[model samples]
Target chain A: MTQRLKTPLKEDDISSLKAGDEIILSGIIYGARDAAHKRIIESINSNQKLPFELKGSVIFYVGPSPVPPGRKSGAVGPTTSARMDSLTEPLLKKGLMGIIGKGDRNNHLRKLMQKYKCIYFIAPGGISAFLASKIKDIKEIAYNDLGPEAVFEIEVKDFPLFVAYDIQGNNIFELALRRE
Target chain B: MKIIKITKIKNQIKKLIKTASFNLPEDITDSIRQACSAEKNNTAKKILELILKNSEIAAKKKIPLCQDCGNVYIDIKIGENICIEKFSFLQDMADEAVAEAYKENYLRKSIVSDPLFDRINTKDNTPAYLSIVPADTLDGLEINVFLKGGGSENCSFLYMLTPSDSADAIISKVLDAVRQNVTKSCPPVIIGIGIGATSSKVTELARKAAFRNLKIRNADDKYKILENSILEKINNTGIGPAGLGGMTTALAVNIEYMPCHMATLPVAVSFACHSLRRASSKILLP
Candidate 1:
């Protein structure tokens, strides 16, 4: 069964999620990739003001293609979450509630997720075109110089995701592997 | 010698890129369908269905199969009797084709100018990884383009083993590699294994094996049996579709081998995500 989630994701929303629960997410989420993560961390470290509020926010690790002529997005899909593992803690520390990406994360990051009460969600990888159809709107919010890797405020409707890790440290990857 | 124009070649390349970007090859789709039926876990089965549906939407809507768009790899085979008209180098022609296709098709420009220090998007997705091979038996130029995304490429592995290592060792190593990195690449991947060349060449062989026609098995009976064995073992790992779990952890395992030094064995493994986007075209020489 699937649950519908509206952002900005709250403590209750994330806490209720379990590993392997399918979710259809709507409302606003932030788009950021490797370069954008670095800048966000640098700003936080320097005590500079961020362009968007991190608290109660969900960040998607992506570098979407240019918008097509008649579409809100062009092949927008989640990148591998493991690449963002090192840069995730600062955002979580600031009350970032959720992350959406593909693949597994490290145990260390899973522990950190539990401590911070953040949920790690996995979107289907390589299904970019289908994912893009769920995107309702997108606007660049910061670091425009990063091109495709820039930060954007994106609105999604019925974005499909599966919870890979929950606050209790339950992991969908391990459960799936041991299912048989 | 017959003369072929660079302009003609570039246009052919652009067509190949467009086709590959929008279409998921039939072999991959068929295998995924087979996996879906064979899947015992509900999560795995659902993921496979979604993959099939996504491909349908991509083709109908003219959307790129993946956002990565990927760094283009083109293997050009030129026949011995052909001469190019005003050709500087193959790379330049291929790059022009890539730039034009990516822009015209709305494919992402994912290439960076440099590897380390000055990481910057090239914007045009130029400088394709081109390998030009002389085709003595061919009557025309054949180009095969493969779009490989970053996630799967990151899972590629290389290992050096003593010559005495048994096939069991190879099997275990492959299982270990997949166990560690399978989910990272996207599950139900096509794995290419190269066992025998020197370190550098082995990976290339693995890449070629990975991207080679999925319908064709290795020519040697020995390697073919080995391929089937590895495939069974991998599926038995129960990593399943999308690593959420099931019986179809990998769609295929292809192994290419060459004779190497007696004292050392070099092995490489390369992966292609389920997308497995590729297209081929031939240029006629007049």
Candidate 2:
């Protein structure tokens, strides 16, 4: 059965999730791609304030196109999550609750998710137009110089996603591939 | 013969760019619809539905089918006997069209100035990968445009094997590559296999094979048999719609082959996701 999750998801809430579970997310999530993730990690290492708080918040790894007239953002879809695996350790340390992207994560990242009591979600890749309909609002937070790679504060409503990784280090992709 | 100015060519290129970007080809849409109906897994079915719906939304709303609009590739077949005022000016005309298309249609500017460094978005999808081929008959130019996204492009593979390698070996490697690349390249993939050629020719044929209608099979009987067999094996993998584990792993498998060197057998595989964006137009001479 499917479940709905609200953002600022607590550590306990994430712990309850498991691989193969379907989720519909609502509330605030931050958008950060490769460049923005690097910048955020640099801030954390220097003991400085991040552009946005990571605790209990969801981070979506996407670089959206420019918004047309009278639109929130253009086709915003999940990029390859594996690319962000290197910066995941520090972000989990800062209490990141969940992540939304496509594709499989490395074993180390899965272990980190379990260790930190977080969950990983997979939004359908290449369905940007449908995904865009779920986004209610968007505001740029930092890295404006990076164009689409800039970090943005996004508010979504009933945004459909699937649980790929849970607190127990279970991976849906691994399970599915193994069954084949 | 009518003299078509460079500006007219520029406009034609611009319109082709927008048309290919905003619209998913009819054959691909039909394939996705059929896959959605046949898909057993509820999750995979749902993902396919979303993809189909997304394409419709993108078309009606005049937005890109995907954010990474991809590099523009133009294939032009020019007739030898056609008289043109300025034959060499076509490349400049196409580049201008790319610049205008990106600015006017709000398409993403994905091209970079250099490959090694200065990895910057040109802010205009300019410097199109244009190829001009001569045709036997005297006629107007025919253009085929393709917008290839980065994700699927990254999954392309080429293998060089000894002539002694059996057909089974080729099938095994291709299947292995697909299994390894499930979600990364997106599922319900259209696979193109180019066999029996040099390394570069194999790669080129692999890409060219993808542009063929998915419903069509290879002309050669042996290759057709191989294509069908491989298609069956791929679907049985159950990678599903978006690798969530389902019945349909691929939409179609197209194979193109050519003569090869005596000692070597080269094979290239190119994959395209559900949103195969390609269009062709023909201009006939009077």
Candidate 3:
């Protein structure tokens, strides 16, 4: 059965989620990709303040297209999550609660999610237009110079996602492989 | 000889890029439809349905099918009887056309100035990967455009196998590649296998095969059978749509082969995700 959850997710909320559980997410989530992740890490290294609140937050790894005329968003789908595996620890260290992207991540990340009580959600890759329809609004929050890779606060309604990894260390990919 | 203006070619390239970004060719759509119907896993079926819906929305609204907009690959086949005005400037013309199309179409500019250091956005997607082929037997010019997404491109593989390797060896290698990479590349993907040739040439062959029309099978019966067998193995892995789990791991497997050195057998595997954005046009003359 599908469940609905709000952003800035808490431990209590995500702990109950098991791998392969479908969910709909509403509320504000942060949009960031490779470049933005690098800069965010640099800021942390330099002891500079983070651009956005990190506690109880979820980051969607995306570099959305230029918003077209008369539209709130352009094609906005998840990018591959594994690319961000090495850079994810700092965010999770600072209370980042969730990540949304496509594909399975490294085993280290799955363990980290379990350690931090975090969750990994997978959005269908390349279904950009239908995914865009879920976005209510988007505002650039930081790193505007990164262009499409800039961090943005995206307000979404009923954004569809699947639980790929949960707090208990269950992984949907492994489960799926076994089922097959 | 017929003379075609450079401006005409550039404009045509621009139009094809825009068309490809928004509309998927019918062969791709039809394959996805078939996969959707054949899918048994509910999650996989639902994902396939959403993919079809996304295609519809993208075409109807003239929005890009994916945010990557993709790095552009253009193949121009020129007939022996055709000559281009300012033929030396063909690459420049194609690059300009890409810049203009990406800007006016509201597509994302994903190209960077450098690969490793000082990675700066080029602002306009330029310097399209363009190739010119001599179509000696043809009567007119044909141009094909493929927009290859970054996610799928990352999944491409190249292997140097012993000359004595069997077909089963190649199939097993491809299966291993797909099993490891398909989740990130987006399945049900089309697998393109290139065997023989030098390493670089084999990779090029694989990319070309990946973008070939899905409706067309390899001309050689042996390669066609190999393609089918590989497809069956990949599907049996049950990677499913979007790699969540299901029966439809791949839509098609296209094999393009050439004679290779007696000492080495080079194999390359390329992937085209379900989107499979490509378009073609021809210039006819009287």
Query: Top lDDT: which candidate number?
Result: 3
Clash-forming residue pairs, model 2: none
Show model 2 residue runs off by greater than 4 Å: A177-180, B1-3, B83-85
Docking quality tier of model 3: high
lDDT of 1 at B199: 93
Poorly placed runs, candidate 1 (over 4 Å): none
Instruction: Give the alpha carbon lDDT tens digit for every residue of A47-160 in model 3.
Output: 898989989999999988988889998889999898999999988888999899998888888888889778999998989988889999988889887778899899999999
- Considering TM-score, which of the candidate structures 1 and 3 is the better prediction for this target? 3
lDDT tens per residue, model 2, B1-286 = 5465667667777788888877888888898898889877777888888888999998998777887777788888777566556868888778888888878887767665676665566667778988888887746877888888777887799999899998899899889998887577777888889898899989888888877788788988999998989888998987877778887778888999999999999999998877777878876765
Using all chains and alpha carbons, the TM-scores for the candidates as numbered come to 0.98, 0.94, 0.98
Query: Positional deviation of B113 in candidate 2, in angstroms?
Result: 3.2
DockQ computed for model 3 against the true two-chain complex using alpha carbons: 0.82
List each model's interface RMSD: 1.0, 1.6, 0.9
lDDT of 2 at A106: 78
Q: Candidate 1 on A1-180: residue-level lDDT in tens?
A: 589999998788877788999999999999998989999999999999987899999999888888889888888888888998899999989999999998888888999999999999999888888998899998888998777888989999999999999899999999886678
Number of the top-ranking candidate, with TM-score as the measure: 3
When superposed on Cα atoms, how far off is each prediction in RMSD? 1.2, 2.0, 1.0
Write one digit per residue (lDDT tens) for candidate 2, span A1-180. 588889899866776787989899999999998778988999999999899989999999887766788987677788778888898999999999889988887788888888988788998777887788888998888978767778989999999888998778788987776775
Q: What CAPRI grade goes to candidate 1?
A: high
Q: Judge the docking of candidate 2 as incorrect, acceptable, medium or high.
A: medium
